[model samples]
Target chain A: MSINRNENSKLDFLLEIGNIGSGNALTSLAEFIDRRVDMKAPRLEFVDFNELFGSVGGVENVVSGFLINVHGDVNGIMLFLLQNELASEVCDILLGSKLIDLNALDELHVSLFKEIANIMAGSYISALAEMTGLKITTSVPDLAIDMAGAILSVPLIHFENVFGQILLIQNSFSVDLKEYNSSIFFFLEDESIAKLMKQFGIE
Target chain B: MGKKILIVDDAAFMRMMIKNGLTQNGFTDIFEAGDGQQALDMYQAERPDLVFMDITMPNVDGIQALKNIKAFDPAAKVVMCSAMGQEAMVVEAIESGALDFIVKPFKIDRVLQTVSKVLG
Candidate 1:
């Protein structure tokens, strides 16, 4: 079941929405560091859950991820993933603090990283809400500092009963003379997708 | 407490972020609550001069908590700590009783500015 084949215009619509979200997220991130963050055009796609691992190098890559379940007008899971070391660097840049070892994380380190994810995810959804005029509320964010595949598996599996297709937005961000990449995966339930399409009047 | 500031959020980290910014900027008496219910209780107990709260949380959200505090103390100084996309809720908070609203991933300068403006 190819989402593009059935809903070409819908994919385009979501791509634009994703672009707005990615742009907004980068802008907020830039503010966090009090510097300009460069962003590339966001790439949106629909792929199988298992293939997600292959999209970001391999399933075994150690990464930091934030999972949020969206409720209200539409229901879905949103995942924010970035490489582990880069996640720590993001903390360093955003907090104006440095870590002795990038791989190691203390309680505060994890908290800071999770807070960053929270803001990014919040900004992403905020753009969607504004554009579609939907009442969207996000749940408490769950952070996983582990293999990318393992962390994403939880939400991907949770949506298995309801959805097979996953929509991902890859956003490239560069700040403070360094570049880091992150992806936001939006797995909407079948009904949720219908609600979103109806809101935009997409057939 | 002298010019106490109350920060509310489910994420301990977010509270820490706000507290860090305020403390660095010379806010001595700072209080924190994990949710809206606790924020209401703390507001009643502490009667802090300013309240900074997140719009979303587990037990009680920022909006309901703001309303509760405003009803309890009509002159309570409340500032909503909202995430970017919560424009609607921010508006509702302002309409209810919030002095102003600040978006998250907040800079210390912006946070301080909001606090000062609210104080004035």
Candidate 2:
């Protein structure tokens, strides 16, 4: 589906906002983990279910997931992904345990990821709120452990190809003296992007 | 101003890490609890001057635990130990009567600063 000129502009605006939000999250991760996190802000896009599911290697091994559902004048979903290994590292860092078993993926691990997702998503949402002058309230992030494909199979009722790109954030963080890599996918709707641009006073 | 502080978290390593940081900064009377219920029990017996509570746990999560503790002592000085992405819960905890919060993967300086700031 092709988005109109106004929608296209909005997409760009939202993508930029996502980048700033993700950047702030990365900085906090770096401070907590004491490691540098590398991120790439690709153009946002709208993908068919098949293509979207295929992009993240089928999401079959996804150990833990966090979702920040956005509701407002505009809407979309912000997803944080951590393969089992990375998820464990995050747990270890927050809990200060080098002996934590990555394979366990226990309750503490899930809870820790939920908190991390909250921070990352909250930072992003706060930035959006400041720029748009709108109060964005995010639901308690829903936590899931499923195959990547299964998770992707869940439909996004409000999907839009705002920027014609996907903001893929790659993070390398360490905890318990171990290092791991993870990524976050942010899908922005075209209308949301437009609202963001107007809020930022971007031409 | 010397005050007793309680540290509640399931992870022994984390409790030790925070204990080490706090004690080094002259917080001599420190107590440890593995979960929220344990924290409440300790709070009743110890009447600690402050608390460092973790948000997630098996028996009772941090936020609920915070509320329970606050119900007993509205003047409870609890500092939440949060991980990333827990901003909403942190806000809730603060509203629920926590004095402040500290993010996990505890930074030595930040922990000390927060502890001193809150305790003072």
Candidate 3:
């Protein structure tokens, strides 16, 4: 299947997939916490490299991030990020205890966050696979709690010469009257995006 | 003593969850491996009656481990437990000799039923 390579069409197709992926993530998280997870409409945008760090509250914002490589029929990078305050609250709920410090996360806390990343990203990829009839697998997630710029730079630096804009989804969801924000970034080259669109018979 | 079972996943929390679930239900003999390589070694060392394997890991993956264990012991009973529940993975695991596939965020009852059915 040959993709038409129309830029707007490609962005539209990606936006559609982003909606599905974020929806799947929200549903999965709700089931994980066994709570009502309500999400605002996800914003899918293509941001230039200079604006990328600012999208997540500047380069120095301390946040928890997880990166997982997606492979098989379609290849890309999946990133999930949460601010430190939200991360701490989430840890409290997930770990079933109040955490005194977000700076020092025990191994168990890290493992839980990694699992959450796995589950959320896996849910998105699973939905994509089911919809496109493609085989998609994810790597075990690598996590970090650092400045947003530092975390975002990993992919940016890797694909600096290859990609001009990064595809990002800003997802906001509330649970039990507390609002939490997260962002999922997909770093795929033009060729990969074309390959993904081709599966949907988008011409 | 119940039949010995092995749980393979990189996440310690996940291993603990499954372990707690099984122990609460009277399945006392449970073993754990952090990755596929460890799973292979533990499988050989413990000769666990059933294995719950995760698909993605660092050193080795569940699919490769499942293949290795099947090669070592054709009678091996393995079930895939992972968050990646795509059709392709499920089919691949089954083709590679997995007896069953259990998607993550699963219910304890479902895990118990798979264990009972496979071990019985």
Q: Each prediction's DockQ?
A: 0.60, 0.17, 0.80
Q: Name the docking class for model 3.
A: high
Which digits, one per residue and each the tens of the lDDT, describe model 2 over residues B11-119?
6656766888887777789999988899999998999988888865657767788899999998888888755334455567778998877765457887778776877
Tens digit of lDDT per residue, candidate 1, span A61-159? Answer: 777888888888878888888766566676666555776564566767776776677777788888888877887878767888778778878875667
Docking class for model 1 is medium
- The model with the greatest lDDT is 3
The digit string of per-residue lDDT tens for model 3 on A1-203 reads 22345577888888888999989987888877677888999988877777787888777878889999988878788889976666666667767786667677788888888888898999999998888888989999999988888999898878778775567899988888888889998877677777778888985
For residues B9-120, write the lDDT of model 1, one tens digit per residue. Answer: 8777778877887877778899999899999999999999999888777788888999999999999999888774476766777899888888877776788888878786
TM-score of each: 0.90, 0.65, 0.94
Q: State the C-alpha lDDT per candidate.
A: 0.79, 0.67, 0.86
lDDT of 2 at B100: 79
Residue B31 accuracy (lDDT) in model 1:
93
Q: For this target, which candidate reaches the highest DockQ against the unseen true structure?
A: 3
Off by over 4 Å in 1: A1-4, A94-97, A100-104
